[model samples]
Target: MKVKLTIKLLISMIIVYYITMTVYVVLNLVIYNSNITFGEKVFSVSFNISKFMEPYIEDLEKGNDFSLDDNNINKLTQNNIWIQVLDKENKEVYEVNKPENIPNSYLTAELIEFIQDPWGSSAPTTISTNNIAKGNENYTLLIGFPIDKIFRFKMTLTDESFKYHISIIIFSLILMTIVAYIFSRNLVKPMVSVVEDIDDLKNGIYINKKNKQGIFKEVSKNINNLSLILKENELQRKEADKAKEEWIANISHDLKTPLSSIKGYAELLKGDQYEINIEEAKRYGTAILDNSNYIQELVNDLSLVYKLKNKVLPIKFKEENLINLLQESIIDLLNNSKYSNKEINFNYYDDNIILDCDKKYLKRAINNFIINSLEHNSKDTIVIVSVLKKENNINIIIEDNGYGIKEEDFKNIFTRYYRGVNTSSAYNGSGLGMAIAKEVIDCHDGVINIESEVGLGTKIIIVLKN
Candidate 1:
């Protein structure tokens, strides 16, 4: 059977308490039977009895009569010990009710020996004696009890003590059980609550928050935090699904335009719709090739986006001159028929400084940046570029006085397929320019920063290794 943590803790604490009480009881019993116990009590009763014996001894030492205190005698005679008063010569002159097997009189040396090594197996563990003075005469007094009889007397009193002992045991059991219950409940309550909270999460239900204190406060707070994270993730998943649907629609639109052109041109070429010459044939052929190239370009862009996003593209790195690469990319873009009319200017201030670079990817990143500016801005827009060396870093800055990004869309400008509200269809294109640029720069262990104001302009900063 599966046991809950609370039950286990309760059982464990109860077992420990039981073991502790059992040990205490047994230890008390052992101490009662040991020689140390005998040594401790033997002198306690003897001192009281000595007070009664003082007068008896002083008179006896003078060969006169003496008396005893009956109450003191009774208190001192816990064990059935023989009590006696003797003269200096060790002759017994008086006797109290003593235990059997103890001799009436003793030679001083025999009594001394018995005191040193007590005599019988079931007798007093040892003897006790005291001296008295009477007119300068000396006397001795002795007492002995049976060890077996003393243990019997103790057992008799212990029988009576069981009434209170059993009461104490029952009382203690009740108290400890209550304490154990409270302790185990506190220890296990938080964990059990957490388990239930997890179950609620699995059921797609939010956990109800409650005020908790002590050690469980952190636990409750963490559970709430985890709930918030899962809730946010759930919301993000829904938004991503919606965004993906719109993105697929946009991609379909981009693909249809070129495909329609290709199909229409091929049909025209195959038809007898009009008379054709070399010039017309060449023009038709160029239009067909242009549409095909446009479709090919779209496919290539999608492929590169996926490869970079999934990290499936193999990239090779070699030491290349970044300053030269940037200048050439701009010059080549100016040479291209598409961006030929765009007024692009660049300022360079460095020689060939070598750095590890993947030529195709890095050049693509710079081209994407330059093209975004030229294509997005008007023909009158002036694009300025500068390459500067600062200690260990090479900084490439591109600035354009074009229609800038809106503040709301600035944060998401690099997210895939996220076209800003202010960006027109002519400028945003596929909405993958900045995202791809950022990813490529990141792959090179470099950084890209954009500073744009609503009506003024946009400036891009690319920092790379020198």
Candidate 2:
């Protein structure tokens, strides 16, 4: 996303320069160095003529009868070359009928021979050489040939090849510039669309449809994902607001019934026309007190649920024996007056399960499951709580023979303030019990699962890691 145009352009330019430089070097080497035989042919012909006249130098130095053959020498130096032979005294012993129009520099030269034969550029016909033979006396041989014209011809061809390579390099640079522009444009296009979407979002315009492709396809995908998340959150928020209003209405209705009954009975006692027994009066007062306490417990549970949802409550996790905790929680639940009349069956297996957990939070989670069962189950039905082992985890189950939840509502049963169809008629409790249980499980990085069939039974399973 942060890719800069200048960086892209720089890289493209470097590639173009490298390719052009490589092609230029290759063409130059091929035209000059690779053609070994071309330079050698000129050298070979010049060397042959010199080699053929080697015996004449010895003959003239020894004062033997020697012929100075100008016609043959003239024929040998036909190819734009000036040939000269010098004697032992450094005097010119032989000269070809060289062209007068030839440069004067070629005609006047002193020559010395190297022990190692000159190779490459130096071995060409431009070289001048002198050879000496030492025995009882010293004899010398010198020869010169001008080859500047051949060098000029080679340079001209090289210049032409370089000119062609320069033109190609210019065209290639232009092509690379075009390619870089297209590539950078394609890469940035999608991001531009995402930026525009952000501007729309800021102005309170939520566009959920994803309508972009190709170069900016990934950007579009990310935008679509963000849009979906926002939409889901908006829906949940609206649902929570509606639930809040319903909860207030339900709480008002519930409080009104108990308060109205207490008010009516108290008025009867205050009226002198009504004959009220003292025991009956006490019973009425106890009923009012019981309902008030229920309200208080309901309010307390609701408060805790809110804290858990907002992450205001902190959990203290530790390693403990889950079996002891489960048994203790059930005993505590049964001690309550509301659940004392309900038949409860406990099935515990020694699964050797030990887990790191917040003891109080997990106990609350289990208590929520028990309370849910008590609230929904039929009178005289037995509720079962069991513990078992799974792979590196402990599975605790609380089951009741109750009218089970609908299949459609299974996934969202643990959500906060989610009351089912029979909630208003069958139960009188805040809808945050299961939500609190879910929060506790999530804190332990565990999971909760439920299995149920309508009008048969409901099973709640909590899995915690060991």
Candidate 3:
């Protein structure tokens, strides 16, 4: 029924109390019975004394010299004994040292009369009489004693005994409760550890590396191993996603080259102004070469992406002069087929801007942005590249006069396979360039962000620690 610890302890204590009380009552009954038996023994001795004293009375009537020993009488009455004796007139003739504090009363009168009367039909077995005939007359010698002293002794013993018994019960209960509390905590300790581990798992924190040992130790170890398995699965999923993006990019580039080559050669075959001559053949040949170069470039870029994902690429990070690196990157972009003819605007503040990074990946990231801007924009639109040095970081902003991204789609532009609204129908590149750039920058502990408006131009901002 899911009882709480405190409640269970209380119930146990109550049961102990009742059991203790029952034992106490039984003990009192045994003690009282013993006192009753002792009372009967004392009464029997008094009866025998009365019988022995009757013979002395008979000798007194015969004028025999009686040497009564007072010491013997004193011993007989010293049991807190109250003896009553009566003569022929039904009068109290002898009353042994009864307490005066009791005050002479009708109880004495009733006791004397009852004694003087013949040991009647209503004789108590606990009291007795002897008839002593001296010469001729009949005299009833009645003797009786009050057992109240014995009763008082019993009461005193019972009161003291009851107090000690009750104390023992109380002390036992208190001690038991303390012992029970310690025992319960020990029993629940392992469960508490398990609960804490489960809470950590729920919060996505690492489990304890220590090997578990307890009643539930096996379960705990199993859960810990399961967490490791789940983490490995998550890592594998990310790797698969990166590989899928690389495959799509390679396939797009491959298809675009053949398609471009076919279109270009077919156009040259149909001469525009010149006649079908050797010049047309050379033009067609050049178009075929351009397509083949495009295919080669696509294959190389795809291979590089694969190496980056697989950690097979030898990315050596060294302190590089930022000015020279950016300058070479711009030259390469200008010499590229897609960006060479575009109107490019460059802004740079010449300084000893140094960075610790792989120069190849950095260049690829910048090249992708430059070529993307030139190819996606309308004919002859200007692409601006600017590098700004801040106090603790460097900011590189690449702005293009092409249509910017929509507000709803801005956040996901760097995601692999995401094609923004501004993408032209003739765009030949895969949608992984920005995603790859973002990943590279992340590995360098840097950030890349994009700010754009629907109709205005888009700006890509890269920030790296100085």
Pitting candidate 1 against candidate 2, the one with the higher lDDT is 1
* TM-score of every model versus the real structure: 0.66, 0.56, 0.45
The model with the greater lDDT, 1 or 3, is: 1
lDDT of the structure predicted as candidate 2: 0.68
**TM-score top scorer:** 1
- TM-score, predicted candidate 2 vs. hidden true structure: 0.56
Predicted candidate 3 versus true structure: per-residue lDDT over 361-463, tens digit per residue: 8887887777667666677568888889999998888998777777655766666655555655466566667777777787678888887776678898999
Per-residue CA lDDT of model 2 for 327-432, tens digit only, reads 7898898898767888777786684467788899899888988887777656755789988887787888888887887875675677677666544235667777
Q: Order the candidates by TM-score, highest first.
A: 1, 2, 3
Error of 3 at 255 (Å): 1.2
Residue 399, candidate 2: Cα error in Å is 1.9
Per model, state how many residue pairs clash: 2, 0, 0
Summarize candidate 1's per-residue lDDT along 1-466 as a digit string, tens digits: 1237878999999898779989988877665444343454553322344443465455445544644566546645664555676777777767776655556667767777667666432355545678766556666677555554332211444765988889998998889888888888887887677777778788777655784667878878887778878888888777667666777888788778777877887887898977778898888889888878877776787888999999986778899887788778988998888778788888876677667889889999889888777776667788998888888888889999988877756777777776555542354267777789888998888999899987788999999877
Model 1, backbone clash pairs (residues 3+ apart or across chains), number:
2
